[model samples]
Target: MSAVLQLLVLVVLAPYLVGLMRQVRALMEGRAGAGIGQPWRDLRKLFRKEPISPDGSSWVFVAAPAVLAATTLVIAAVAPFAATVSPLDGVADLFAVVALLLLGTVALALAGLDTGTAFGGMGASREITVAALAEPTILLAGFALSARVGSTNLAAIVERGNHSPGDLLSPATLLAAVALAVVVIAEAGRLPVDNPSTHLELTMIHEAMVLEYSGRDLALVEFASALRLTVLLGLWVNLFVPWGIATSEAPLALLGGAAVFVVKVAVVGAVLAAGEVFMAKLRLFRVPELLAGSFLFGVLAVSSSFFLA
Candidate 1:
């Protein structure tokens, strides 16, 4: 029951989260911008249209969106979103979750190349480059956080955290939080790494790769992209701040937990929106440097745990 609720929230609320971010950005910039329902409308419009594939594109192009969205849904289910325990915890480990996300990334990258367009190839190259740099930071950062509970399984980490929340304020925790925050920006294709609203092929990382997709395919891809951001942010929040998460499967606790989870994610959404307002997108060549700095933070986080904690 908790698993079902978790999955539903991830799927149904993911687009709304994206819309909220846009609205937040819009208000910060002093423009009304698109309303909070814009993403939902966009998805509905895309699904109602016809899907077209690029010439010579293989089945991978057609299948990448499903794979991406499915993997994201899987991650959300396995993680303890609104509950301290997960219905799918048996298959959910920190390492396994990260690997599943990487699988989706690889599939999309291959699909980008399969399109045989220069923009597709360019996007794939840039996305893969960032993925390679970001992957290490993810592993190291997760390790830093997991080290406190002495486990790499996310459920275990969250469960242990319920018993012991003191470590969340330690130097190691702060370092890991900073590292993961940087990763979230890069992984989710946010500003300073990549812009979701941009059409400039030369500067686009994620949008460029999916430029050839249309209709349902594009809807799935865009929905998956939004889901990706939502899941990653939720996971980070649950990891760093496990407050209000129900440790039981009781109905009331689930309700309370769900409400708290939404509030927490909304707060995070606003912070991310405000953050992008202050920073401009970095040059493509300088992206690696930003990722490298994140890697350093992750390493320091791990080392601090060993030496200081």
Candidate 2:
């Protein structure tokens, strides 16, 4: 109905999307996973539990969750759920969205370092390194889409992509999509990049950073991670294949738009789940090489956009 309400829907729906992904992954592996609302239950249980801070932890430890949640909620507010309209539309741009996402990332990384644990420091170092390398590709790929539309606003990108199914098939758009997809895997801690479910210290990039946080704080961080995944996937949908995104405010139009959006997200989630199940995690040292290839692809995409245009 309203932008505020739609924003709330995105927040609430993000967790379910995570659950659905888990369920799909489970089904693919022939294991029955927890129910689709498990994330909500996990959050509720965590909130009721008492937090346990490490002996050396300080205010930075306590503030990390608040900052992470606030940053994610702000990013969600600016992200268009149905179409071009967002709660923070006037202040939102594709590049600004990228920055906000990175801000949350930096805050978490700093908090990880503040804990002074070996794993925390190591994770933070790896996370920032991956981030530093991934961010340029993210911006350049987004710019490729924006370059075609002549605006950096995310909503505009979606609006234009929706009208042109062939938009993504363009050499620039395809190359950018491939690059952004790699960045998405890295940014979201998915398999073949950084495995979110890993317990091994040497392999973990995200979990190691949060190993010191417990109870509510850990829950917030995990939830934010899930939200980050949703944001990245939504961006992929909007910028690459925005077929069902609606520009109309009418009841039926919005309803149809919502239906299409759900189906599109589900399809993407299932595809990702399957990919994860079939793919092995990459060696930690080799991660940069993969990301570097993505950056090169993105560069080619932008070049194609300019020369081919």
RMSD of each: 1.0, 1.5
Model 2 per-residue lDDT tens digits across residues 115-172: 9899999999999989998999999898888888898888878888877778778999
- What global local distance difference test value does model 2 have? 0.83
> CA lDDT, every prediction?
0.90, 0.83
lDDT of 1 by residue, 17-132 (tens): 99999999999999988988899999999999999998999999999999999999889887888886766886778888889889999989999999999999999999999999
RMSD of 2: 1.5
Query: Which residue ranges in model 2 land beyond 4 Å of their true spot?
Result: none
Query: What lDDT is reached at residue 309 by model 2?
Result: 78
**What is the Cα-based lDDT of residue 128 in candidate 2?**
95
Point out the worst 10-residue segment of candidate 2 by lDDT. Answer: 1-10
**Model 2 pairs in collision:** none
